[model samples]
Target: MSNLPPQHASEGLSLADQVAHELREDIIGGRLLSGMALVEADLVNRYNASRNTVREALHQLGREGLATYVRNKGVMVRRLGVAEVRDLFLVRRTLEIQAILGSKPLREYQSDRMLDAIEAAELARDREDWQAFGTHSLRFHQHIVGLLRSPLLDAFFTNIAAQMRLVFAVAPDEENFQRPWLERDHEIHDLLAAGHRQAAAEGMNRYLDDSEHALLDLLSHPTRA
Candidate 1:
């Protein structure tokens, strides 16, 4: 993986936010494996941040569902069990389906952004940049949710998508897992562009269903990295 850009105090972000952003990227990029311990002392040493900053960053990750604070275990990158995986996908399916079915007609700008996101993902895939591919893939879906123009829903989906990355990090054959979805993403976008709202919603439903099964299958019979 490439080196993370250095965080500067002059950047206007809080120290905690900077720390959290770096650690979050590590988790999503699979640099920090699931269930790996996140020790405050270790983090402080690594980031050269204060203990309070590390603590706050860890709390932020907890809120994003990227980490969990166990009673005596402190913080660890969350490892979702089979049931939790299914439950997360269940809520994801519901939210995405609602967004697709109830969203306003696609504004031209929204369409353009969606297409850009897909194209970016394709480019990333061509370069075997799985991290960028995953990032843009989420952005593509985020643009679909953006159709609702609801800030609350956008924030909610963003949080869920972060958790989804945990699952993506653990899946075997990450390239194969992400490849098929590129076509489905294109099909969904095409349906929306054609003004076939119901068809697009149905297409999203199928896409989510297939994704849920694939992830669940991986959880059931995981391949160790």
Candidate 2:
């Protein structure tokens, strides 16, 4: 399969929406790095769309808080700061743990998604693809949010995931940065799958706490991180 995201192929989306959606996916997928310039000319060529369409697309991203306009610098992927990391985790804990705690007794399909993410991470680890491992780990949490069955929160979490990836990228030691939590992802999934949701919720809270602390530490010292 091609590594490129689909361009202008989905039904019912307008030209500008096509570009915005693709860029949004690129951001969440980490193909577009935080603070990377979103040049109008380059985007026009890349998406095979008009310059106006690209501008509109970028406007949409800016509205979504995934990108921002800077003085003399034009638009770029939004660079999250230390404070944003803290707030992101606060939301993560709220939505993620609540999903686990709120979903009474749990269900196979929900747990299945978490299990699939775990297996994907293991595959990435076996291949020594640390970046893919990080992506899969995020997928695990995305599945956790899925247990809530709220489309609105699911959509909001997509933007949060993009910001979260930017925070993770700040840590140069990516393997050591993400490895500890990979185990936790598996552990929580096991607890949820086995219907031990209270245990799973507790583990999730601690996991987010530790994860947030580590991220803030990384942001504070990116060079050494």
Candidate 3:
């Protein structure tokens, strides 16, 4: 228990949702490793939340497939098997390819969001803010999906983005590792804005392929991780 003051658990969002977000982010960001038991009493004390809130939060995480409830081991962060990582990336490729294809001609408002997200990503990179970059990069792509004007697609892509980030958290040298993706993503955005949707989609496909390959390779050989 570090001496950092606990945040008021009831400050804003519903207690359960707030706790869920905190725990989810930590698990996905690698602050909490896979298979680490989530002791509810410890969390209640750490976040100054009630036990019920902690349990509700754990349940939420389990629903997201970020945690598991064991018969005697309590809640623990999930460990993605190699096959699962590949399946996840395959899902990402399909969804993102569709998002780019459907986005068609990019609008000014959507471009603005993309640029803002890119700038935020660059700033986060400069400051070594991997967490922020991971989050904002997802937002950048979500904005692209939003431009397609399909709420269903937006929701689908959001879930895909979350899972990708969770997979990314387990990789080693993530800061340097993600640079290639960032570069390709930047180029893809430019192409999309310049009315080259096909080219942008192509670039996105290649990016997804490389990302999936790298992540799968890492997971297969944790000794190199």
Candidate 4:
């Protein structure tokens, strides 16, 4: 692979840190799919980094549960199983529902962030850019969890989103799989914005149930996807 332009390192981030952050975003953004080999040599060339930097980046992904070391295969994207999917959904429900129903007052900036994600997803869908649509859709939920104002939960959910996108990679039809959630996200946002917390919570519950069921079904029957 030809070497690409150097990463624009964030302030205070080392080259290795920048490489790892970019790789993490690729996973969360659906550019890297589950079970795909993360070849060190190619990555070193692609990111314009040394072998050590590339190895460190891959190790970061491994620590984040997004990559793994295979004896002969080196490192590859971690292939998730059904049990992890179920457990992820459980955590999704717990955190998202509390964010909606908890006594903490809703913040305007948080609401605007969610709206921005929804509008971005809508734009992506309009352009038939399903991959970008999926990223924004995931961001919508991440912002929902952000409403709680806890940095720890926000960070945890970022990892969850990355892992969840790996599962999303297996969907046979991206448009068909992701279109409904866009509408549901909008509806829930509307309810919450109008101060209808109970209704929003109910809509969120339904959304989570439907989403978890669909994903579990897809994982259980890969042939269907």
Q: Name the top lDDT candidate.
A: 4
Candidate 2 lDDT (Cα, 0 to 1): 0.83
Better of 2 and 4 by lDDT: 4
Candidate 3 per-residue lDDT over residues 1-225, each given as its tens digit: 322224644445577877776775564444776677999999999878889988988898788777888778978877777787778767766666777787757778888888898888899899988777777777776776676688777756654565666677766777766655567668988998998878888988888788778878887776564
The digit string of per-residue lDDT tens for model 4 on 1-225 reads 432225454355677777777777888888899988999888888887899999987888888889999898889999998898888889999999989997255578878899999999999999998889999999999998888889889878988999999988768888888999998999989888888888888999999889888988888787784
* lDDT (C-alpha, whole model) for all candidates: 0.81, 0.83, 0.74, 0.86
| Candidate topping TM-score | 2
- Per-residue alpha-carbon lDDT of candidate 1 for residues 1-225, written as tens digits (9 for 90 to 100): 223366545666787887887887675445776778999988878888889988998999888778998888988989877787888878877777787788777789989999999999999999998877887888898888788788888867776766787788767778878888888999999998888989998999888889988888888788833
Score every model by TM-score: 0.82, 0.91, 0.79, 0.89
Quality of model 4 by C-alpha lDDT? 0.86
lDDT of 2 at 225: 50
Candidate 4 deviant stretches above 4 angstroms: 1-11, 103-105
Q: Of 1 and 4, which scores higher on lDDT?
A: 4
Pairs that collide in candidate 3 are none
How large is the C-alpha RMSD of every model relative to the true structure? 3.7, 2.4, 4.3, 2.8
